[model samples]
Target chain A: MITQQDFEQIQDAIAGKLSADEQQAYNKRLSTDSNFAEDAFLQDKLKNILSDKPFDEFRGTLMRIETEYHYLGLWRTTETSETFSIEDILAMFEPVAHYEQALSHADLRAAGTALLQPQNGSNFLPNDTLTFAWAAALTEPLVLSIENNQEDVVLQDTIETGTVSHNITLPNLPAGRYYFKLTGNNSGMYIGMFFVNKNLLDEL
Target chain B: MVTLQQTQAFMNSKHTLNSNEQEKNTRIIDGFKNNNTRIIGECYAEMYPLIVRYITNNSGDETTAKEIIWECFEVFFKNCTKPDFVLNAKFSSYIHSIANNIWLKRLRDNKKYTYTDITITESSRHDFDDDTDNPYASDIDDYTDQITETIYENDLSHVIRQLLLELTEECKTIFRLKHEEEQSHEEIASLLQISIDMSKSRLYRCSIKMAQAIKNSPYYRELIDGFPFLTNYTNKKRKS
Candidate 1:
């Protein structure tokens, strides 16, 4: 079993604190004993880590900071004021939309809404109940509204469960490009569009 | 609505830190490490609205917003102390990613979130950045394992630093002066209003306590038992 002395010896050897004669002896043990060699290698890794001044400095800074917190009694709430609303905390981040993508005119209508059932530009019967998809899983009920090219609301309904996908029936009207908007409980709005197959209706 | 240009400008500004800017960043980082409540509070207050908007805009209430935002703050503070950490962007953007991931994970857990074949918006794409260095594919818990690993692998020195920080006030001061600042026992004693002999002995005891803590750590136990180096090395040797 490796004793404390073995550990010390390994550490010293790795740090080059061992004398030439002592180093030679340490190397001898490494060549002779496999276990000692493995321990020595580990000690070497530890030595490298320990000697990292930048890392150690960072650690020292953290310790001082932690200790400072202890004295300040800031572990809980502020002594001077009442706890504030959490929404106030978000101000620390610079308000920015990092997610922005240029979209085609058709995709622009969808406005980056998650779509599952109706493929964009696909032909659908006017009387069909098309399955709608949204990328976000919202617990609150949402409103699904469909409008024609003239921006007239054709179908508007409330879905109780913001399931991954839901079926929404279309109003039997002239086949044309229809834009859809999905809005959840203060969650914001997402949009997409689908086409009513005028030719398919003619065939029928 | 922060644009990509704004984000690039913020990150780019970090490369040009004047003395005041450097000092301010240091103070903020130092305040967090030390748990200066005022600094932390102000920071929390500032970040709260952003978190609230994100959560509220996604069907969440204030309570849910508070829990996720606070958790993200803890992670953000710890991340700031990472050695040689570069300020690559507005720290808010980084926090934004973490908070968003946590909420997304929460939604998935409650079965409110689902995957679809639709194209992702810029908002979802911005979530690719992670602050915690968490390697997990999904944005959720298993945080206890990570906490242990952080002390062991990612921040062993920092763990020791924390342990030292947790010592009694006298011990903390004496140990910091003695070891970190390399102050002579006489200097420490005079500065802290203690006898030189007392200072020496206190430093000694504090060192022993730290050593004990290290030895008692589960990571050290595994290391001592040859679980990592020894077993692996022996197996490799045997194979060879």
Candidate 2:
């Protein structure tokens, strides 16, 4: 029977905590006593079993990806002509930027207008052409500005009124959080945020 | 952070046929071995479409395709962890081969689908053989053997996780503190409101209980029987 003291010694030996004299005695006993060696091996295995963080973490990631894919309607029951682009797949794994925190004090929507396309907190690859759309049309020209996380304007454009949607080819920008705001002269302002990730594009 | 145009130009210029292939393969293998999530995610994104296409061609749906691909990844990742493991084929080809085998086996087992009815293309057979080079034939066999061993390991891990769930809440907390949180005995004692000696004793006792549970598990017995070198202690203890 292994006593607590014996178990403690085995743990110490496995951890390399024993003094020089104790280490020599432990080695001698390990070579001579089969039970002691067996106990030591078991303790080592137990330590491994307890500290399997990598396996656990990998498994968690796999499950999370699977669930995200399922939620994204990637799994199909029958053959469909539609396929996901690399950007679409990578966006699913990108961390969400809570851009709402930036607009908490400001009004996000105008009185009758709604921002659509490139949903809030969406991710985009640099230089990709994106269609920005809104529901309501104001008579005055709308000023559109894209700002980086530091609130510095990166791209500025003026959208002619009567058109609810405008196609803008995003300029090459560094990978980080960005917010776009649409302001009308008389109408209130509409704001949304997105992320530019260059890493995935490079991988592609 | 290069401009997008510069990055594209660089990518186009950097594509040397042989070196690029070798570098990409090395990166993928290392990524899987190290459990790099970004690399794995890239692999998933790249291979998922191919697997889905192959499965859909073989009278399988995307749901089955997803299941088989994930299972292949588990086996492949486990094989990558083995010290002697080698990848003789492209990572995508190996994964495709594993997914093909798994899907075919499933089809064969199901009463609705017959082996003859399923189409096995010439290219897929070549991939399944994974015998592009004559010198690496034995390594291909090793891949198969490793897959089998990895399946068993996956089962054993599942069983172990289940056994962990059987541990008492207090035992689980103690384990999390010691192993996951890497807490010292004094810290654990302070958190749990117990003496340092008691904290140490509790951890030791919990480990002993876990060891006993693992030894008594049927999966453990099966693993030991299949791989006798795993433990001589069981046989010696039986005799003594």
Candidate 3:
């Protein structure tokens, strides 16, 4: 059994955390002694451990960041301000897709809807796009503003799917951040916010 | 994410024993236990990735690798701070060695040992005492030459990354600090609120696991063939 003193001394030397004299002494003794094979083995192992990895395995760690959920949401009724957690709703959506194609194409809004209220209530919808309008409603409200060269002329159309699209025209509007507030005429209210660059639009 | 400086400071601090680091370890042996997360967290902050890399590099799935690594640390930490326990080596090497043993034993137990055409021998002998100043000088040169030749050919790194993804959050943290940050076991122990012995053991087991992982992998085997020191050494001392 190695003595604590010896072990500590050996460790200190190996770590290169030792004093000059101690280090020199360790070097001298190790050079001549075969019995110190254990120490040599330890050093060899340390070298193996510390040796520059010719292969960059550490880079693989970066991939983990993608797996984390950047956004989590609470679903809101399309008709009411009442809020409820969609966790149970999400849990019920089982066998929504194959194990590999887990990421649904739907955005957060769509994913939120699928997670909150599954269509069959039997299958788990993994698609991100499936959440759609209900998901947009669930996210806390955000204000969206569109700056145009002219504020008077507006293009508004309600798609047959009940989805509404608004195109406002403005002349000489400066480029800046904008917020929009969306309210459904029906019981379901949905809000979506995005940034618009008038300068870029003007060029087009 | 435990900084090296933070780990150093923790090594010098006296707050851990006063806290429940020991208490939690005790509970692990008896049943499920949760302790000071931040402290326990330090141990895993960097260790997780190392474990994953080791397993994945060798040839194991991430889930099995993560499970094995976690189990090794859990058992190691549970006994690390026992007043009677003493740390014998760098936590990194210790943890790696233990993990390697565990993985090797598993492979052996499962009868998965196959003669991969590389003949392992116990025939060659060297004269230099391993502890001497020039002990491994020749070996190093040979290993370096082999590695330098194959630097561009091996994809051992890709396999390692695939396995790393399977590790738990705790395991990743531990691996980062130990391997990437190069912190010592004592420092890691205090930062993680685990025993110094536990930290060392984890590192040892992690290394062993990784080595095994690499050895078991066909890609790693092909690469190691070009790595003279690793190949020659194993052929002489660790033949299958």
Candidate 4:
């Protein structure tokens, strides 16, 4: 739970605007407090993403394409290519997820992390319990977060342990895809995507 | 501030695409238009590690490196979509160079990456900080200025703009003013001719509708799921 003041202090620290004592305190928190460190990393990420001009333009344009993609390629039955079907869109998204997982392999290799169950492109029932596993022998905790496309964090927490697996009973998760990012110890970031089928995943 | 044209020109001028390369460029553009994730994914797989290595080798932390690599991806994708866009060199090399350029800018602004052995290359040279480009005459200028304002100031995505469009016109105005313009609720209320309390209520309503829309829209469902930033914002907002 990052307060507004923590947000400001993190920004100030990132900007090098903090006074010596302030900087010292911030640095102390970064090293000793896992939550503080995660918050700092998240804040820095937001700042970098928001500060970029050229990239946002590209994203905006690509989204515009996405808004109209169904109208092209497969749905050109009539003059209005603007029309879209959900199934067609989902089909198109398949490769997007595929490639994303492929790209993530690089980072996962670097971090020595691998997502086991609900693997990329794998389907799971909405009601089913999900198990997330990673390969690790860490001296420090790692922050695992599941985020939506809107850049919002749905599930996030610090994973503290030598144990390498986590089993979670998802609370009626909305059906769709999600990005899971694992970060800690200032080593490397491991990113991947998974899908939740709208069909009720049975809790057996 | 960079106009879209100047940005295009700066990018296109960097490399001269041969006739064969032009067709390949077209295919790449087609790939993006068709949501050909394989091409983009391939680029990311090959390029992300290169960037990570570059960033960690310098004074930067892994966090900053991930940010820069994502930035490079965005820039590369955007450049691929431009009307006069070209790939004069190898796609991997081009994006790698752009990543290099982005990192140097990051280092300059932060003054944190005090590198001892990294030699600056031609790709490291960029004038993103320069404010020389000017918008031209007429309503085109107005539109261009609006875009310039959005890019240089707002730095948000089209998805957000689309979300705001889901609101009523008045609510949209209030949100644009409050979020992008950074206006106070009092100011937004004054400008919109609504009470301060009403302004807050409308903002709250707008947020709810916005979230609902993201949840409902399949376009967003497929996208938002894979994007951490959007979900994080809503999750944090829900907590707040």
Candidate 5:
């Protein structure tokens, strides 16, 4: 059990406010009850701050960049091409876990870290994010013409399968931009259109 | 004297200083968004070492520390571009706190919670002068004397702030925003100009680095010396 004094010491240590010697003393106590060393209140306070920041406008915009190309000796530029689906796209996206809360506790236990990795597994909740594969499959790649745009954007890698989503980075995009049109298995086309924004990501 | 709530609110608020400091931060961030290499270089130069030191001290090794610090700032500037965002809290504290929390959450999620040697203490100051000789000395000389009290209070705050500043700008910003400002996600995004998702990711990364730093610190190990719960946890995981 943590005494109030020990708790106070833990706070002081974490705050980086303890004297060298005083820190030593507190360390001695912490060795005994390290669990109490954490202050959840402080953690929650910090978590909130980091979670509320803005999105990377640049990367977001770059992700939508479309390139024009000629295939099979035909001028089937990217802008006016028809939609198609790749197997890699289907395998890449994992369904969100459909957790039935009222079901047996065993089912919930099996759900385990799935709750944390909401992007993967079955779509238990509406907010659960689908994988990049799903995103690509649902919104098939938009083919455009070279004359329409000269931006140097390419599908860097085959969008990987599984539930994990990946982001690609593009640099030196000009200010003026436009939208992308998805073409594929016309079955469920026209899901959504993404606009290229002028926001840039911070250099890591 | 500021109340805890007031301090937390300041850290948490979407709007921070109405003074020149706000303008400076905004200008710096704008330079970053515009890729003004010169200005951004200066800011990164000032902030990077602090982040390195902070992450290295926590449980994270050099690579993890580097990633956390960079991500925190990357996320920061990403938000700085947003029109609605404003500066919030003392940037230093806000960053530090966020880094620390990220590391902690990682530990929890991994179920790899372990302890390292850390030292904790109660008192360190000693007075040698007789109670009467000093001109500005307090009339009383209790061990719990008011003069010593004042000294501790003043010195503690300064020392802690200095140490925290030694951490990366992101870590410091997170710590400050969380503890001093006590702002919410929407408020933080509005202040920093990043999206909520980016903010969460940054915070997680930074906090994980901080936890590792504290754990790696020798003093932290010392603190955990005799704690049975910690011993049990560590023994169960058994770090090689």
Candidate 6:
């Protein structure tokens, strides 16, 4: 039963646009007439509902970022690479650990590898200092190799025997996944991976 | 593998973060308060591992960890946006505490898992308990209250937003201009290349349609039923 005029008056009153006399009249009708009061109340609620544009926009941004994260394989199951082909795993930035687990059990025992830092499938900023460690008792020299997804060696280093750990300050690597391999003359090779996320760097 | 000394050393490392690290924390908190997408994404990347580690170490899995973290972020984001909100701890620590609380509540609700008392870590415990450092020392209660209010408002807004989408494109544009941009009818008419009268009439018609739709909705009826003051108006409308 509220007319266009009534609705306009209610909006004007809510916006505090009504003149002194008009405001007084609107207040009287609001107190005396339940219908008008209800209309006004609903109008006020509608205005509030319409003002949620910022929240709606924020949710849109969150969804976009979530989709990007999912595409980066951040939300994948922590299963070993046994479930996926090498090509399938390599196609995305897989954050799985112990890629060597994909090898046969005999190769694993023969490797006699020590614990490695970064445990594979971890994310790091470009400027982060990574600690690469291996077993200390081995007398042979170890070669540390880091390769990009394209199989190009981006970084390589040599470690002398008796060195348990080496700290390397990472270069400003672009955002993507990179694989690192540690090969000892007498021990098994250790393969691990990490991601240099530009988004994390930009945000920080 | 983790000894008490190692844990203490790790905590000490956190406290002794370099100036750049402290600056990074400040930027993250500022960006979070401002709703920066890049910062939010960074938060996910940095904190997700900690959440997953904690959840997996307890009685939860990756999927449950994801759900709880998302829910905690939603609530945490809302709380951070409040004008009076003051975070006394690291942003990550605050969110981790929220995730812990939410996971514990979920476990308690499911009742299948035996209630194991999960202790809050040292950093988070200090953040939660120290009133001098934390402005919102009683934030658990505040968060609960805000969450309830957010649920109600979000539900109502979501329904209204869906209905608004059902409107004609022109009607939607008019609503956006009038409500969001606060454009007057004259300005709207000028922008839309329509007469002022046409602009005014279209807006009025749109508003009426929205009002009628809301009035007939089951959600609106439920809302009114819960609010006694609104129920008085419903009773009068019924009598009329």
Q: Among these predicted structures, which one has the highest TM-score?
A: 2
Task: Please say which candidate is ahead in DockQ: 3 or 5.
Answer: 3
If ranked by TM-score, best first, what sequence of candidates would result? 2, 6, 4, 1, 3, 5
What are the per-residue Cα lDDT tens digits for candidate 2 across B88-140?
Answer: 55577667667766675566546467668866554433433333443232223
By TM-score, how accurate is candidate 6?
Answer: 0.50
Better of 2 and 4 by DockQ: 2
Ranking under lDDT, best-scoring first? Answer: 2, 6, 1, 4, 3, 5
Select the stronger candidate by DockQ from 2 and 3.
2
lDDT per residue (tens digit) for residues B39-82 in model 1: 66555555666677777767788779877765566565656666
Model 3 RMSD vs true structure:
22.5
Clashing pairs in 2: none
**Each candidate's DockQ score against the native complex?**
0.02, 0.17, 0.03, 0.04, 0.02, 0.14
lDDT of 5 at B192: 88
Backbone clashes for every candidate come to 25, 0, 65, 23, 111, 1
Listing candidates in order, what is each one's chain A TM-score? 0.40, 0.46, 0.28, 0.44, 0.22, 0.45
Models 1 onward score TM values of: 0.29, 0.56, 0.26, 0.30, 0.25, 0.50
What does candidate 5's lDDT look like per residue over B1-240, in tens digits?
Answer: 999999897544433343554575667767757755434444444444555566555555766765555544555554455576554433443344444444553444345665443321111111211123222222121222222222222222233333455689887786567555667657777788999766655655555555545446553443344223244333432221
TM-score (0 to 1) of chain B, per candidate?
0.42, 0.59, 0.34, 0.43, 0.39, 0.53
Q: List the residue pairs that clash in candidate 6.
A: A111-A188
Candidate 6 per-residue lDDT, tens place, B1-240, comes to 999999987554433334554576678767766778767766776666677777776768898978766766776666667787755445665666677667765665466665675443444344323335433333343344445444444445656777877888877898889988899999999999999999988988888888788778887666555444444434443343
TM-score of 2: 0.56
Whichever of 5 and 6 has more DockQ, that candidate is 6
Specify the poorest-scoring 10-residue window by lDDT in model 1 chain A.
A94-103
Q: Best by lDDT, which number?
A: 2
> Given candidate 5, what's the lDDT at residue A23?
65
**Residue runs of model 1 more than 4 Å from their true location after superposition:** A1-204, B1-46, B52-91, B100-170, B179-181, B189-201, B211-240
Per-residue CA lDDT of candidate 3, range A1-204, in tens? 334455556556546677777766666555555334333333344343444352122222212211111122212122333222223223322222321132332333321232233221121111212122332332232222321222222223232232222223333322322222233334232223222332222222
Stretches of candidate 4 off by over 4 Å are A1-204, B1-23, B113-240
